[model samples]
Target chain A: MYLVEKLGEKTIELFHSIFEIVQFLLLIFLHLVNPKSYNPAMRMVLTKQIYFTAIGIIPIFILMAIIFGSVVIGVVIYLSTAYSLESEIGSIIITFVVDEFAPFFTALLISLRSGAAINTEIAVMSVNKELNTLKEYKIDIIDYLFLPRIISGIISVTSLSFLFALIMLGSGYLFTFFYMDMDFNTYKYLLLNAIELRDILTLIFKSFAFGFVIMLIPIYSGLKTQNHYTAIPVSVLNGMVRLFVAVFFIEVLSLIIQFF
Target chain B: MCENIALIKAVHENMSISEANTLAVEMLSMIGLQKIAYKRVENCSKDELLLVMFIRALMTKEKSVILKLPSEIIGGLFHIENILKDMRKVNTSKEIFVCDLVSSKAYYKECECHIEESN
Candidate 1:
């Protein structure tokens, strides 16, 4: 009987989570459909979000991408050479680096950094009655708060993922030059030739979806926080965990679709 | 049927950039807070913030406005009275709902009803 009750509770929690996500997405859709939603104040907020999430992290993101890309390229080259399958280097790099690692790493970085911050900030606002204060002022929270963050998340993630792919691919070429007797032009040719239109489109779609989940999960968790101070940390933890799970889920789904 | 209705809380209000600036200056001067009118809200004292919010709510030409007084400022009946007086000057016909922890019947002569929360 206890086991059945726990299962039922879990099922209900899952349904609630889905409902919250759908509700948030609906709000974003409504904002897009309404021209009145756009204002200078919201534009300022969106620009700030993009700056903090994408532009601010560029230095660290580039460093991490370089290290990871070099390591992956080194391993791929060593393995391919040992097995005498050197010709397939471009295909392997395209499949692994461009299609998978770029979006996954970008999502992970964003979720860990910006997602946690957004979650904690929103949670604090909710707990402090700031959100209630906004309501009292007859301000639309959706137009002022949610829409800007949502648009920022989508734009930042897509742009950052593209930048990550470009930097990593360049790093791979530099590693090839240092570790092996390969020309930069040859490596560039191989990578560019292997990348197809479908791969680019898939990468874009995955980044967009991952971005949506990153912002949505954090915002949802933050909104769940009540007036209690204890709820803030709990909301942040829940948001981060859910964001990572959603990222991996999307990545796996994309891979399956591409292969099958 | 004013195009904008505002509930005054903290320092946030719904107004165009130009209107907000103009109103903020005018209301600050009216409330004897002209010196700190342009300062960031985060730097303002609780009383100052409350005064700003009161003025913001009053500036709205809307038919109905809601003003939520933070619990900290409820004891300041003098400030509340001045706010109501200033509001009367702006739009005598506009209906105002002042929600606070304390009953403000003594300070506001125009208030028609008092609604208390039952614990």
Candidate 2:
């Protein structure tokens, strides 16, 4: 029984990878061709994703960022005051908010919002032959469904992350100013020239790629649906798994590219 | 039948009608171009499939193939020429284990026209 379960799991994983490859390529094709096949469906998907993902996360993200920021500031001040690194307070806040936390949080929030939702929706759509029917109707599926989501996901993720990062930075700075009483100008001096153009570019690139991959993997898996309704949940489940895997791999790759 | 012969003759020099359509559809599928539809697979002459495939390929790649389509008997011959260029790159990528599927003969002659048009 143990050996049989292992074999079954391995086979499923293998097939999942195969289907994902095919689906991603197909979507890429649809993307490049700018299919006008399904405008209404595309718009609907976009509207729904925006409302569910971008709308639902704002308050929660802000609150989480505040708590994380305050705690980090408390630690920074405690250590920096003792070590004579008080002047580096601003740099610490900026790095924590921008470099490490912002992107990861943005990706996480967006993943929860768009990744899970799109994967399930597409998987369901696929099992129903909805995608195939659109094709049969000669409606351009790319232009309608996928592209809109891509655009919306990028915008939504970017906007929300920027908001959360700002809140965290502000909260951290407030702690530094009030409790630590670090000189504000010294803190500014620490960070103003510290940010390189490359770092900014890396941040944008990382966020964009995160948004892209999150949407890409799930939708790709969803489109591979065979005509069985069970396949819907199964594909979505597989997509969720792949989405996390891609996110992890991309994060590592981005760090390597940015630093090395 | 003379009509079938005429249709086949009209298709082009080498590929039969069915071969070209299947080849065109298969090639499109191979390249991950799902949105590019194959409407009315039959009744296209080789020349027509040649024109259609060329147009479709160019469009799929987001190249401007519209003006070139009416330029010659082969219409957008530039489309096929570009495919040939990509095919040459495939040879180089093959050594690195990357599959260069786009550089195939689907662009060499519009078999789509020959097959589908003939059908």
Candidate 3:
């Protein structure tokens, strides 16, 4: 009976969180289409958020992508060659790197870096009552704060996922050239023949979904913080954990959709 | 400093940045603190903070302004008159009310503004 009660409590808590997220998502989407939400201050914040989330991380992101991409692509090539399944190499790379790994990996890196920062920033702002100051002045928080961050998250993930995929493909060629004695034309022809419009669409859709939740979850969790300084860290921790879970959940859902 | 003061008007009223900025500077000059126009909040003295808060209060569309516990912002009973003088220099027509403790009533004795004491 005690175990049943605990399970019921946990289940109710989960639904409550989901209901809150959906409500917040609806609120954001409504403001997103409202012309007035993109006032001068919001435009300024959007530009700053894009610069901070996407541009600032580019140099480091590129280096990490090259290092990580080379290893993953190199292993894919090496394993295919060892099994004498080199004819299937293009399809394998397309399936693993293009359709799945790139977007998933990019989302994880961004959630770790920018997601945590945003969560903490919002949490601190809430505790300090800076948001209250905005409220008293009739400035909309959704327009001024939440929308810009969420929009930037979507832009960053979609663009960076494509960038990551490109770098990985480039690194794939290097591995095939030096280690597998494959030429550039053969590799290019292989990938082109294996690629399809659907694969590209899936990548785009998956990135958009991933990006939306990454920022949305954190901002929601941050706002859930109690009106105390001690609540800030707890809010961030919960936000980050929820962010990772949402990332994996999206990835799995995409996989299921692809299967059907 | 100017952005903080102009933010509400700029955001709420959809006023252009330059227009809001111009208004903020004019308000600062009215209070004789135009030189600190670009200074950050932390760099300003207590009196500057109080004056800036006063300007922000005026930025709202409301006709009357309330200064709840002015001593908390300006830091003492001794400087209340000077703060009141700074408030009067600004060209706003908004009515200003100074709410303070009965014990601090002596501090505003020399000022021309009206004071209401609450039990």
For this target, which candidate reaches the highest DockQ against the unseen true structure?
3
TM-score of chain A of each: 0.94, 0.79, 0.94
Number of backbone collisions per candidate = 1, 20, 0
Docking class of 3: medium
Q: Select the stronger candidate by lDDT from 2 and 3.
A: 3
Candidate 3: lDDT of A122?
A: 93
Local lDDT at A211 for model 1: 84
Clashing pairs in 3: none
Q: Residue B111: error of model 2 in Å?
A: 48
TM-score of model 3 (CA atoms): 0.92
Error of 3 at A2 (Å): 6.0
Task: Please give the range of 10 consecutive residues that has the lowest summed lDDT in model 1 chain A.
Answer: A36-45
Model 1 error, position B98 (Å): 6.7
Candidate 2, residue B94: the lDDT equals 22
Query: Native-contact fraction for each model?
Result: 0.05, 0.00, 0.67
Q: DockQ, per-model, please?
A: 0.16, 0.01, 0.70
Q: Which is better, 1 or 2, measured by DockQ?
A: 1
> Residue-wise lDDT of candidate 2 within B21-72, one digit each (tens)?
4545544444333234344435444444443444333323232322222224
Backbone clashes in candidate 2 total 20
